[model samples]
Target: MVTIKDVAKVTGVSPSTVSRVIADNPRISPATKKKVREAMEHLGYHTNIHARNLVAKSTKAIGVIMPSSADKALQNPFFPEVLRGIGSVIHERQYSLTLSSGETEQEILAEVQRMVYGSYVDGVILLYSRVDDPVMSFLQERDFPFVMVGKPFEKLQEITHVDNDNFTAGKQITNYLIASGHEKIAFIGGSKDLFVTRDRESGYQSALTDAGLPNNDAYKIHTEFLKSGGREAVERLLSLPVRPTAIVVTDDLMSLGVLSTLEESGVQVPRDISLVSFNNAYLSEITRPALTTVDIHIHELGAQSARALIERTVDKTVPSRRIIVPYNIIYRNSVSEQ
Candidate 1:
């Protein structure tokens, strides 16, 4: 058992100095930290994370709550990319990540409660935002440290969150379709309860209003963020008396389903119908006649949320922040000049 005292003696530093180095305390000078770390490594001394956490009153773990079950969310590439980003930061900071596994809202809430009450995590990162979410309310009531990856339903200025300007992105993408001569444009979005869908849909409506285009309620379809949702949405669009020539899908995964369904229906993309989507996920490029989409920087959204949550856990006095990541349009082969 290589103890802190043994490493301290070997490095000619006090045991307390060695402990500070292990804790990564900023008060320890860089040179001393390096020396103590080297000596600890040479002596094969590994700090007991559990013991350290007990003393520091920190689990050094972060909880990530998904909008849906892990099985469903993982189907979308966005979630995986975001997790990768979050993991990168957590790994660097020597923290662990605990993902919520519950499949329903109630179950998820229970999982969150367990994480908080059981001291399983130092903070939490919410992967989605909804109106009057119980999870959000519970965290607020407890004054627990948490950060959301999307805009809050209310208290826009108070809740710490990391998100893209979804409304602007939506308007810009729709405007692109309009500029390319698309008058009858359709929108396919995820659940209406989600803040992302509402914001983007509002932007789409705003763009239509600005262009003096008809805003047909029938043209807007809301479904899950999965491929089947896109497929179902396309069925509705095709059955309409006046089918749209361009569609702005809120998710790339759903767009894939739209593309497949359209192909099966003999609707030539861009010739009969142009398709654009959000999230420049890898699959967007591989699809035949690749999709024109918005790059929302999903990874950055996750990384920033984790960073903010960690900051909050460290210093609760820090003011809440709204971090908005930028978006860019990836003009691919999916859109055509109508």
Candidate 2:
């Protein structure tokens, strides 16, 4: 219950002087500032951020918006890696990170509305971008300062985003598998609605076409961003009479699931079917057969998103930015020549 007044009384300075010290006004004499700070420490004083926010019209905090249905995908290593990157910048700027996640679109959009109208955060960062997303529509409608972590399905010129060159990643990984002597390659990706999935799938197909490899419709599969999703897709694909000689999965976690299903079915990787995937996440190297994956620089994606949002918050007139982080393929023991 000790107030600024208590610090002012103890420090023998005016209440305004204590207030100026708390705000780091720089106008206060250094000697007086030191005494006021010491008195604040002795009084266990904390500045009222809420009151300051009212005056400054900013909370100095950023709200992160996860995918509408990220309950499962959020558990993946990608989110945490990106968060580390986002934290690196936001913390340096003395801003706090707040998260908004929900299992449904309505729930997620509602949280976003609360953040926007309630003045809870100075900016928002969306971790996923998809086609026809309501939350995105709302943000666009409000002209709120926000940044997306992936390509916007619409309003490309209006939305600022940071994304990986997933198409090139898909093509490079696919090309690598083909060069290693695998022809009958299958692709396992996430939901079709996701920009990431469609871009990667397009790249995979382009590589197949350029290499004169058969781009069989049956070889392409889409599933949830979950481990079981990989298991289920592989189970179905393995039952095909013309099984693929190799697989190009879109995510490392799903690749792990595919590896699990292969083990349980007595199908040896590389020896039976070479595998390549993306994300280069933590689990990729630890499996019995280390996976060859595309390193999409997940952390950079987050950092750039934070940097973009902070920039927009500072100067709303800044032109929208589209940052594409680079990717590279990491070869390991997962693939062998067919």
Candidate 3:
């Protein structure tokens, strides 16, 4: 039953001053703001966010649109870690997170539109970046505030995105395979349309070329970056006349699938075929061989994305930013000398 009016009366300040204090407005003097805050705490004053947002024209809620049908969002180690970072920063800032997923592009766009124009969220953070995605276009056309988690193929200078040097990560893994004495190496990747896929593939190709190795199309495979996809890619690679001695999988989940198929096919890991994967998911560590993979700092990626989105939302005058988190290679039992 405690209200702003009660706190204002106790603190000898107007209700509007109490409101500004609650919002941590810099215009309010620190001493007055501290007094108002203490009065609010003493009176157990709770804010009516709906009414407040209506007055301020902001929901203080950020909409997060992830690939709903990916099914792998929860199963994928990278996403959960990134989410943790996002959640931590949002919570600390006293903001709310609204998660949305859709089966189709139209559905996702509809959800985003609803979140924005419907006044459900002040801004949005896209979890995936693709070439000319409708959702990205919609936000850009209207000049709505948003941030993407991956780089976009087009309009690199126009939009804000948070990502790591995926090209370098891919090349590093490929170089590791080559250093291990594996002349024939294969690749299992996610969707070809994805920017991450292209960046990684480019890295893989660059490493092969630099090492004076032939880049065989037969050794390259494109999959959904899931366990089943990895399994299928491995099956196809094994059926080839010249099988690869090692493989670089773009996702840890797919790597697990490849390992499962390899085990069933009586291929001893590192002894018969070495493997390297990305994301450094928990599954990587739990695998029989404890996969050697790249750590993309998933949590930090999420946190940074949230921060970028928040900054964009709050300060419209700030220029678009492209932030690159760091990555490292974690050596483990999944890779061995040829």
Candidate that would win on lDDT? 1
lDDT per residue (tens digit) for residues 1-338 in model 2: 67667888888887766766654543579999889888777766755434545566988889998884456657788888889999998887789998886778889989999999998998899998989999889988898889999999988898999998988888888989989888899999999989999999999999999999876998999997778889999999999999999999999889889999999999999899999989988888898799999999888889888877876775566667689888888889999987
Q: TM-score for all predictions? A: 0.86, 0.83, 0.84
TM-score of predicted structure 3: 0.84
Model 1: how far residue 137 lies from native, Å: 0.3
Task: Rate residue 10 of model 1 by lDDT.
Answer: 93
On residues 1-338, what C-alpha lDDT tens digit does candidate 1 reach at each position? 67777888899987767766764644579999999988877877755545545676898899999989999899999999999889988887888999988888899999999999999999999999998799999999999999999999998887999999999999999999999999999999999999999999999999999999997999999999999999999999999999999999999999999999999999999899999999999999999999899999988888888777776775566678889999999999999999
Stronger candidate by lDDT (1 vs 2):
1
**Decoy 2 TM-score against native:** 0.83
lDDT of 3 by residue, 219-299 (tens): 999987678999999999999998899999999999999999999999999899999999988888999999999999888
Candidate 1 global CA lDDT score: 0.90
Residue 35 displacement in candidate 1 (angstroms): 19
Worst 10 residues of 2 by lDDT: 46-55
lDDT of 1 at 206: 95
Q: For each candidate, what is the lDDT?
A: 0.90, 0.86, 0.85
